[model samples]
Target: MRVTQMLIPTLREVPAEADTISHQLLLRSGMVRKVAAGIYTLLPLGNRVVKKIENIVREEMDRAGGVELQLPIVQPAELWRQSGRWDVYGPEMYRLQDRHGRDFCLGPTHEEIITSLFSQEVNSYRQLPLLLYQIHNKYRDERRPRFGLLRGREFIMKDLYSFDKDEESLEISYRKMYDAYNRIFSRCSLDFRAVEADSGAIGGDVSHEFMVIADTGEDAINFCSECDYAANMEKTPCHIHEKELVEEEGPLELVATPEARTVQDVASDLQVNTEQVLKSLFYNVDGKLVVVLVRGDRLVNETKVINYLGANRLDTADSEEMLNNFGIPMGFAGPVGLREKTAVTILGDLEVKCLFNAVAGANKTGYHYINVNPQRDYQVDHYGDFRVAEEGDPCPCCGAPLQVQRGIEVGHIFKLGTKYSEAMGATILDEHGKEIPVIMGCYGIGVTRTMAAAVEQSNDENGIIWPAAISPFDVLIMAVNQRDELQAEFALNLYQKLKRAGIDVLYDDRQERPGVKFKDADLIGYPVRIVIGKKAISEGLVELKWRATGELIFKEKDKIIAYLQENLTAMKSSKR
Candidate 1:
């Protein structure tokens, strides 16, 4: 490719709307352009990088015994209705009506279509343990699409669905995909971790998300300090509280605590330790009021609260509703008088019931109760794990402290059990000649997001540092002072030689300043740069630079081709 003929509109200034480093660099390098709030058009350079990632995914998926196939992006609403996800997916699904008024949706996933296909064709155990995959466009109506391709409403994705006759067979397919994911990201040179994750709307028995570690990531991940336990912050345990139950404590006393509405305020006003203050929160669980008790320093995990309440949604009781509808003071509601409401239930965290002499709200406007004991003052309907996992909290597996890191999720694999198969009546005969629902597993890689996340994980202040395996081009032939006859001759010779040697080379033949050419070179982040300057003509020495390390090495013009061939091969296959 030559700069004079290509659409390499490298920009000197970053766009105002580009938020993350990847977004800014992508635009500045003339790789992608914004089409809408969450939509983008991949330019020549961007499409090359995307194709490289796609090929890697295809190679790995095929190596794992997956047969590549194309599924429709437009699916019938009846299929989703049969799978019980038509309404459950909510507004995120891009639903529409065709000319005949038949309902359809642009699929964010292909589980329903895949299940329907299986129901029609795969009916016997002989066709069991099948893995099929495809790389295609997926659509989702994101409410707020920011961060470039990271959360785009329309993007490319690779989805692989597995069907097996039973749970045991499903495990074999799941493990194959899991190992393939490890190889795919490893080849991309990503610093990522596979952590336990909630299935969310996908609905599965177990799932794992592969996340690339980055400071600008949106997901919080908890990792064990001494073991292999890693989980998404939404569900990692704050660990089981093991404080012994105090048999006796100071007597209960009501104290004046005017305007102390928050746990910190109460702790400060009462001159007590934060751990010694018992805080109660009012939540509207399935339209019923429930007061949850925890230590002042602890935070509640809403997912745990929702699971405990067995409800689809869990929301904090409206502050005004606590006072008007329930006659409970905003910050002064306590479990001691909480049961009198009859309709409100009291739930306690494991640590709440073990407090010795804790200070608690008094259910009055201007006062709080001090030296209250849960064993004597309040009745807890249940005690369970309900607090957010915190830094330095003990690990659930090995008892070591945990650490939190920000991460961008790029891939997810789920052990889906029979969620979709049973719902859609996708059944196959068992070995014993009995018809049973097929067990399934879903595996996905965000093709576009993975490309952006690679930038997030591997870039410098200058611009994107694409890994060798996924770079737009393997070599950049930079002609310094292209007007100079000697420089142009040397650059053109080297560029032709590289192309003849079957290398993806980009030639900078445009009439531009050396500084402008160098800036664009770094912005594009080609792995190897060959500089043909006056030195190449005068001393027969070509300047060789590695984009990743910025290492400069002088090589004779005659050996430039061989040197690049050796180094480029190693770089593409290198792990780091």
Candidate 2:
């Protein structure tokens, strides 16, 4: 690719709206352009990088015996309805009506469509195990799309589904997909980990998300550094504390906590640790107000609460709703002589249930109850660990200390079981000719997200240091002064040689200043750069620089190709 003929619109200044380093460099390098809030158009350079990532994914998927197929982007709403996801998916799904008034949707995912497809043709156990995949566009109505491609309303994705006859076969397929995902991310030069994750709306029994460590990620991962235990914050278990309960001699007493409302305020005024105080939060669970109690020091895991309540949806109660439902104010509401007449279900944490003399709300302004204990002071219906695991917490698996890290989710494989197939009526006949629901496993990779993540994990201050496996161009041939006929001729000659050697080359033949060209070269982050300058031309040599290490070496013109060949081979070998 020649810079003179290509639209390499390198910018001298970063865009004001660009937040992350990847977004800034991507915009400055002319690789992508933002069209709307989160939508972007990948230019030639960006497209090449994305294609390279996709090719890696495709090869790994193929190696894992995955048969690729293109599923429809716009699927009929009936498929979603059949799978019981039409109402469950909620606002994230982009729904629409055709001219004839038939309901349809731009698929946020394709579990229903794929299950429906398999149900029609795969009727026998003979075709028991099938792994089908597709690389296509996906749409989601993101309420607030930000951070460029990191979180987008529309993006490209590679979604694969596996169908099996039973649980054993499904596990086999799931393992294969999991290994393939590891290879895919490994090939892309991503530092990632497979952590346990909640299935979310994509109903499944077990799931694992491959996350790339990045500071800009939105998801928080709680991982045990000493043991192999990691989980998404939503599903992370709060480790049980072994604190001995202190038995109180007196009964529950209502005290004037005057002007103390928040847990911190009440705890501080009472001269107690946050853990000594009980925090009560109100949430709308299945159209009814529910008061949840937990240790003040712990944060609520809403996902766990929703799963525990067997509710399809849950959200925190707003102040107005809280005022309307509970007569007490927001921060002062707690379980203490509260009317059991209201259909409000009370839920407490394991620690709260074991408390002997815990403080709680008096349900009146500027007042609270002291020396209150559960089972004696108030009755609670349910108790569980509805709090998110925090740092220094013990691991549920092996009792190791837990650590927290932010990671970008690149891929996920889920043992969906009969969640979709059963709902969609995708069944196959067994050996006995009895019909059984097809077990399913879902595998997915964010094609564009992987590209951005590569940039996120690999880049320095200069720009994106793309891994050689997915670089837009393997070698960048930069002519310091294109107007100099000799430099231009030397650059063109070397470019052809590299191309003939089956190497990808991007020839910078533009009449730009050396400084501008150098900045752009680094910003684009090609693995290797060969500079044809005055000194190099005069000395019958070319300056070779490694983008990753910023190491520079002088090579004879005749040896340029050999050096690059050897360096590329070493880089490729290192990746393997």
Candidate 3:
């Protein structure tokens, strides 16, 4: 492709709305443009990158026994209702009504549609272990979409669903997809980890998220320092670490705290370590008021709480709600008299059980209880792991200190069991002629988000450093002076030769300065750059530079093609 004839609208200045590095570079490089707040128009270059990623995913999926089939982008609301998720899917679903007043929605996922289809089509165990997949657009009305394609309201995705006869078959299918995801991301040159993750609304007991390692990522992952254990912070298990109670079990006594409200404030006023205080937090879980207790130094992992309670929604109880509904002061709420004030359920973190002679709220303003003991001053309905896992926390697998890092989730695979099949009645008759629900697995890769994550993980200050396998073009040939006949002729000839050699090459033949072309070359970030300049005419050599390593070399024009063929293949084979 010739730059002068192509629609490459490179921008010099970064846009105001582009906050993340990937978002800024994508917009500035003219690969994508904003269509709306969380929607974008993929320009020619951007589309090429997305298509290349899709091809990789498609090839891997096919190799894993997946059959490609397109499902409807718009689905009937009745399908979701049949799966009992119509209302449970919440506001993220793009719900709409037809002119005839029937409900429908743009699909955020196709689990309901696919399971329903399977129920109608397949009838026997012989047809089990089926894997169907598609690469298409998905819509979700994100409440606060940001980070460009990473959290877009509308984006491209490749989703594959597996239907199997039993849990064993489902396990095999799940492992196949898990291995395929690893190959797909590695082919894209992503530095990623398959961390154990919470399934969330996907309704699965086992799941793993392929996270691209990046400092600007939204999710925090805790990985074991001694072993292979790694998980999303929300899913990382906190093991019980028993601590000896230094103080004897003293009689509980009320102490005047004055205006201390926060845990830190209470600890400071009382002259005790934050760990010596019991932090009481009230949450409105599925409309039922619940109080959770943890060590003051620990933070509540809301995901754990939600999963434990099997609640659809959870939010922190506001001050007004605490005072008006529960008759408890916001900052002075405690478990000592919480049941008397309101018959709310109380949950305590496992670590809270080890605390003896701890300080706690007095259930009255400007007062706190000293030498408070669990099961003595109050009772807990349940005790579990409710605190967030921290960096130095012991690993659940090896007991080594955990290390924390940020990462962007690019793919996810789930062993869905019979969650959807049973709900939708997707069953097959066994050898005994008895019908049973099919086991299922779900796998997904965000095509467009993968492109953005590549930029996020691989870019430098100049612009995006796309992985070689998915770069818009493999090589860029630029003439230092297009007006100079020697430079222009050599550049064009080399471009043609590379193209004929089956190399994706972009030729810059525009009437632009060397500096402008060089800047654009770096910004667009082609894997290999070949420059025809005075060296081409004087020494019969062309200037070659690698975008990734910035290695410069002078090669004879005759040998450039063979060198690129060998090196690009090696580049594609190796992960970044």
The best candidate by lDDT is 3
Residue 121 shift from truth in candidate 1, angstroms: 1.5
For every candidate in turn, the CA RMSD to the true structure comes to 2.0, 1.6, 1.2
What lDDT does candidate 1 reach at residue 74? 92
Model 2 segments more than 4 A misplaced: 241-244, 573-576
User: How should the candidates be ordered by lDDT, best one leading?
Assistant: 3, 1, 2
In order, the Cα lDDT scores of the candidates are 0.89, 0.86, 0.93
| Decreasing TM-score order of the candidates | 3, 2, 1
Candidate 2 TM-score, C-alpha based = 0.97
Candidate 3 residue runs with Cα over 4 Å from true position: 243-246
TM-score of each: 0.95, 0.97, 0.98
The TM-score of predicted model 1 comes to: 0.95
In candidate 3, the residue pairs with backbone N, CA or C atoms under 3 Å apart (3 or more residues apart, or in different chains) clash, namely none
Q: In angstroms, how far off is 363's CA in candidate 2?
A: 1.5
